[model samples]
Target chain A: MRSTRVTRRKLLRLGALALGSTALAACAALPTGPAKPTGEPAKTAAETTGLGSQPGPTTAPGGVPVKITFMMWAWSPENEKFERDRIELFNNSQTKVVVEPLIMPYEDMWTKLDVLVASGQAPDSVWYDYAAYKLIAKGQFLDLKPYVDNAAAMLDDSIYDQGFWKPAKMLGGDSPYALPIGGEGMNLFYNRDLFDASSEPYPTDDLTWDEYRNVAIRLTKEEGGKVVQFGTSLAWLQSWWAWVMLLWSRGVGIVDSHFSPTQCTLDTPEAIEALQFLQDLIYKDKVAPDPVQASVLSEQGGDFASGKVATMVDGGWDVVSFRSIDRFQWDIALLPKGPKGRISPFWIGGPMISKQSRNPDAAWEWTKWTAEEDGQAMIAKSGQQVTWLRKAREIAPEGAVPEHYSKRFETLNDLAPADVWSERWNEILDKVWNPEFDRFWKGEITAAELVKAIAPETTKMLQGA
Target chain B: MGRLARREALECYLFISLAVAGFLIFQAGPIGVSAFLSLTNSELVGTPAWVGLRNYSAMLHDPLFWQSLKVTVTYAVVAVPLGLALSLLVALLMNQNVRGISVFRTVYYLPSVISGVAVAVLWRWILNPEFGILNLLLGYLRIDGPNWLLDRQWALPSLILMSLWGIGGSMMIYLAGLQGIPTHLYEAVEIDGGGMWDKFAHVTIPMISPVVFFNLVTGIIWTFQEFTRVYVMTQGGPSNATLFYGLYLYRNAFRYFQMGYASALAWVLLLIILAMTLMLFRTSQLWVYYEGSVEKA
Candidate 1:
């Protein structure tokens, strides 16, 4: 009766109460599930592939499909379609599980996945990269070993290259958290035309380090004091993982151990020698482009792709971009061997089942299928990557443009996963390693001084500090 | 209170209710939650455990934290004052009644309205050491330009120089303030036998002091929150030389998934901004000449 008079104070109080209620209701109504798909649902695989009548797995119990979501970054329109097609094939192949594709922009994929996981509504499976080590350390992934053990026929261990399989197992402390799909390896990509113009022999599998530097210097051409063409491009050294190939090839590593390390090994004489060799390439020899010159070359097309550089140590994935180059013929060769041996970095990516998934069994089924022969065939046919399956590697380069597609396979023996399995990998790379090395690359600090400055911090990080 | 007065007040409150509700629900609510989040160990996965003040305490020993703070402060210190003077000068020129004045004004203000990412990309091209227009021009003078973004010595300065590109926004505000000044004041200064400098110092400045003050506060805030250019161009690299606080905070939140620590860092930023604004407000009585204000008199 007191507030029925509609006084100003009463009205104010009523409004306040209404707002508070609305806010509380909003907070309560917040969805505790995976974010709604930002992209349109892709056409069903049957619709696109003309395989509507193909037999799939038997229906789930009582004929209700166990719905699960598979999330991946929207790499490109074609890649998205390919992924959707892959998902549709799984759907057509299995009636027991219905997997929905959740495509997000590449930049937002990880952050959104983290939010979904935190909310206990993670996607059933996710396409993950090297950064998966952080989530794997958090125990966010299902231990796939049990699934692998149960389904030995479908998920055979012998089919996967140990180089790819070992890192998957190593990431989860010997519990396989993911199935091996494919990997990209670093290799020497050279312009055949540039080498031909220089009258220099093309790089071979047995090329040595000193010989590689000499080749770079000889091929480097000058036009009116400005270098028109660089002999070799060391622009790949900018990446924290890429430069470690140098250290690894030298029979030393940035850390004492690849898996578990207590101290920094970058201060070793061998390590400093390798790093100094890289610096001398820029400052002394002036054959390779420094960071500044690299930026300019990158703007044109790329150092190697622009045909301004004769040779480049880059990823095998460059085959995709290089395929578009009609200006010159290009091919791949084994990375130059160091004194110790020829070792290159390999980066593997695959789908990992989330621990919080409601249908982890279904997710496992999907994951295992992707690693099976059929999935490997599809992957190889896509020509997107070098499949990790031993059999698939033979056919992966069947229609590939790289003249020496076999060179990619040849380097498999020398390929080792970069030291990215640790949870602190990103932090160590971003906070300590890259910055100090940037100074080294710029001639602001010596390799010895760079190692000395970053060793303590890197050591602390490796010790789980 | 009278019936008419009460009814007027009620209507006023009703009209503003939507805005007030929006502020409380969206802005104030998140701020409150962020304060609570700052006290917890939320890693963007799993339940956030309450660790109360540990995140804040960790900042004390964090070298990157100190480094980012130093970088942000250095940027703000240089950018804010330099931006103010430059924008005021630009506004003075813009206020002149000349040919194609509107066109000139639009041209100056156009860059401010373009998207931030586009501006960043354009600047990246402009500052490119080898092919960039900056170095190309430097080459014409027979001076080899230092690597602007790649060098540790020049990265921070490069970002500071980029900050000046958007001064057109502040210039517009100053232009508004300049246009609002009465012509009688300049006439008075002229009658007092004062020249152009005296007229500017006594008439134009005092009248525009409030606008200057507003721009100062905003400039400080904007420069402190700088992230986009640095992110696109360097990613806080070439040796963390340009690692702004906002960039580091973003790294902690998204990249590292240390949301609690990032929340703590965000709160610290808020406090720093608040203290600066408060100090400015406290000192404003001496400089800010608000017209017909009893407090200022």
Candidate 2:
């Protein structure tokens, strides 16, 4: 009995010693702010514990719990409910990690986020519209390459890895700060009824700008100097969607062999030719408007709903909107080949890792999860957006998969030129390029002038702080 | 001092101290920060570096900044006079002894109580391009009304038109001034065998000129600070046709993260407004009338 009491005290001493040593080690190694802004090596808490390059505490004394702050743009009520429910399910499965989501309005998000990031505090992980990755250069976020490299061992190679080219490069071969999660590229969404009335085929894939113009003119109907069913409505319509596809068909683009900002390759004759073709669609053909004169975007949508346009380009994820328009019969087609190539302007959101994280191992785990089938599928189930994961490319472990979810991988081309362009793409596309292109679309400026305007503006936006 | 009296003094200090502290911390601090921020170049993510004359130099060439200033000045120039005139007119009309004058006063005062955003949205719906009720009514008259808020040319003017809808606060002030105008002055003018138009021209015009002056100066000050409506409406777009000074400042600071430049812009605007106010006041000595006046030396 006396020996047993001694053993109990001895066991307590051993446990207390272990706890005390851990506390001392933790005190000795506090997390300093990240070493450099863009390219800090991924270091985990285990390394802080004097655990000789092991990286992280794989298992806890009892069980370590992780908290991940995930943020995205605010969504509709139904979508939010679905996401929260799915997150709760994920939490149940992963006893270690807890994901807390933050949301703000879509349009207002970047402004608020810019402010928040300036304050030197950001969520553990965020839905980074990779276009804003330049903020990484400014020291707001982490270079996720190291962590992704670490997790590559755990990823199911066949299912998890197909769509990645440079793994890091978003567009061609620029810096890769994130993996594509959810996205939509432009697609030709047109009123089929308008096509039927005009005895024309819907603007299907494989049509060139010249071909599209011909069809647009064919559909255009004017009565008493008033357009009853105009060929198309151009709302927020810059040639960005057409430009990507057209530039690729012509092999003239902003990205070079590697995904870095190439010089204005399109500033030359081929790009001029492309612009002339687009111009033909507007003034010469008199099919689409000199979009500059179109009413506001909200009005354009209303006009389309009222059956005023035969063909229009809209985001693919917005299929539900066209589907819900009971007043008009509409259909969507994959955007056709442009003068350049078979490319479409895509908008994609990537998951970004925070620069300052209490648990990078956990954060990285979440990043991998978000990039993997489970995370992508979880986001997809919400139906707010589509995931870029070549979902069909998911080769389940030798017939473990149900058949239906696999086919979706075929349609998931998150690597489209638009998504490839990522965060700063919008700044150029929407802010700089789109405005000048608007002038071109308006015939206020020539295409050459539009190209000249973009060089300085795009150059300014590209320069790192 | 006695202990109780000292305690009383301390208590009084404590009572007012919270508000003073709040004013210093929240208001004054931000203003100082923004001013300091204006003189520096700030990265969106990193520490703001002091770039003494860089932001100002940049501002000289910044076409957007100039455009915004022009728009703001235009908006204020158009909106203030129109708003003040309409308010004064309504106040004068409502001052007549008539049925349910209280109700008329309430109705006139209601709009200004509504916030700027609500009023902007309400007006946007009214002035919508295609399906707005205002256009529908205009259509019946065989009018092909231009898209008011959407078109670059008409957008700023539409905002001006909307400003007239919410002149109630100014109207109430004018109403008070109109009431203060002694009825005996009108009677005296009438006793001179003057007509209604003549009496009003001599008496009513001079009587509320002080109120008009007050409204004018304040209107200009507030107009320079105008941001919310433009932000909500056009975001200074359709080729930045509606870009205003304050909205530009906000874009620089918040949207583009050029906080220092924005701050410098703000200080410059303050200086401009101050100069304009001084000039207006100097000129006021010419036209603006007070209850009693003596010739300047």
Candidate 3:
């Protein structure tokens, strides 16, 4: 007992010393912004296009120097660099429009824009999400119908008809307030090192959730009943593909067809089967971390970067971070097919135009450039952001990304459903989905109750206030 | 010569004009607009229309607003007395003529100087159930700590613990009050054959009563307005357990964009603080003893 007390005191002293430093480190790590005062947004290809050849705003007879800003998120420095190259091309080539780029945080950009637009301080243009069409109904967003019909109408029809653009185009059968920019879909990431080390059969395209579970169970090795590795987690925040798509494969939508929140269908018997399999990795099977243990490690982004888990549900962008993982070879695969025989795919974030931007024309031009094949390709290469454009299949080219990395993109693009387009889109969908989904993942609540839980809030939001 | 009076008045007005302008700009101007907003049914889309007393009537029915009020009151009640008592106890401990006392004072008060968000994030890690040092420490005592921030039942108390970490600042104020008591009074009590307890009981209580009154009133007022710490921490969640009034006001204003409703919430909060402070002053007659001839003062 005395020894325990001595050990206790020593531990506390050490913990305090560690915590003081950790706190200081946290202060240092808090994200900050630019040092200098704000300047014009980063110039885009549209603005800088044909610069020397085009007429100046006042002096030039034909070419117009349009100044515009486009807000962006979720691409690596490499991808951003490629996009920046295109922006220079546009600025140099075209005097018609000057589009600048402004980067925005992706987590919950829509609501922030909504607030901005309501206040009339919106940027000239933004890369708006499909759901940003909600602003059109409020009269906050300008109708694109006139532009789509008239001048500045060089958009591809194939891009417009893609499965993802349908809901936003109709605005749930209303008006199309936004045009498609580029997007990434979620897929399962599998670590090849773990597969070879355990001599587990690599997951195949034909595999079901059951086969996925078998792989997880087999890969899980226990020495003294503690798992060194976790199979999968029903993620709580930011990284939400595992929860959303897995549920989606079961035909449990985050919001219903009309955009009302339905109870978690993922928690239903079929969904529960998937969840129980996930839980078996933790509670019964003991192959994964519990909620507390899961959080103690780095975030999903960091863990995947370090190549810790054998398989995690990841977005099309996950491969962007795999550039440095020397410990293991990895690739993206379709989420194991559920009973639905459909791949669970979701678009990450959508761009929106601010209703209140002073340079609405400039903003529209920037928004157009975001969806253009060249712009999409540029953003993709600089950030390895796989775009949703019909031509995005050419992203990796022949020898750019390693053959293995390129193959993941092909599988993801071919097998995955084009991203779902919907209205009433905001971070609200994220809220109604998680925690309860997490509880459902833990088998704390029945799937039926989970679906019932989110219905009203979803209904109200989808209906819109 | 009489015109000199006008010149003097003009100079006096000029000197005070800047301060008055600032007060009007930052406070009075906003308040006037907010009052106007509270009477109208306004959406950010177009002009707000007059809907007198409608926002107040709506507040009565709003379940979330009431839930927020309940949480705010509970937070204020738990935090204020506990904070004051802890501060008083620490102040008493430091009042003794001990070694390196100034250094001790600085160390104890250091936490108060740390900003709210910094302290909250530190407490978040400390309170984590899985790998936090707090849980680890509690484990040595064989008490399995709850997953504090994640648990609705314990989230408020977890925030209270964070609030308590900064009580050192409040305690320092009390410490200064303690030191201000003359040593001669204790010597007088000693000459009369009074014990240390007697000296403290008679001399310390009356002398520090004014300080206690001041701290109590201000602490309650500030706690009622508390928002930032909770905003960063739980965001009033794990299912609305920590949703205080200020957070509710922010949501009504920013999230829902119901500025008029938020103004009403502000007014209600103002009235609540006024009532509580008035009650404290009314009750101050009994225990408080002031040395000045004006007893209440």
Which candidate number would show the highest TM-score if scored against the true structure? Answer: 1
Report the C-alpha lDDT of model 2 over B1-297, residue by residue, as the tens digit. 999999999999999999976565446655666666666675445566778878888878877778888899899989999998898889889888999999999988888889877887778678876667888898999998876765678889988988788788898888899889888888887789999898778888888889889999999999899888888887776677887898878766555555677778988999999999999999998888887688779
Give me the candidate number with maximum DockQ: 1
Model 2 scores a TM of 0.80
Candidate 2 per-residue C-alpha lDDT over A1-465 given as tens digits, one digit per residue, 9 for 90 to 100: 344555877889986676544432232211223433322346541222111112243333367667777767756775567656756766665666777877666767776566556544457777766535556646556666565555543234443443443433543434456655555556666788888887787664567656766777889988898556668765434545435556665667554422455333557667777776676666776776553235533454554666777877666555544445776677666555654445555555667777765555565655665555566666655444555454522323221221222222323343354433333544455457655664576677777777778866665665531
- Which candidate wins on lDDT? 1
Mark the regions of model 1 whose C-alpha exceeds 4 Å error after superposition.
A1-67, A74-100, A153-162, A170-172, A372-378, A394-400, B1-13, B47-52, B187-195, B295-297
Model 2, residue A352: displacement in angstroms? 1.7
Chain B TM-scores of the candidates: 0.96, 0.89, 0.91
Residue B234's C-alpha lDDT in candidate 1? 84
* Candidate with more favorable, higher DockQ: 1 or 2: 1
Clashes of each: 2, 25, 38
Q: Evaluated on chain B only, what is the TM-score of candidate 1?
A: 0.96
TM-score of 1: 0.87
Q: Which of the predicted structures, 2 or 3, would earn the higher DockQ when compared with the native?
A: 2
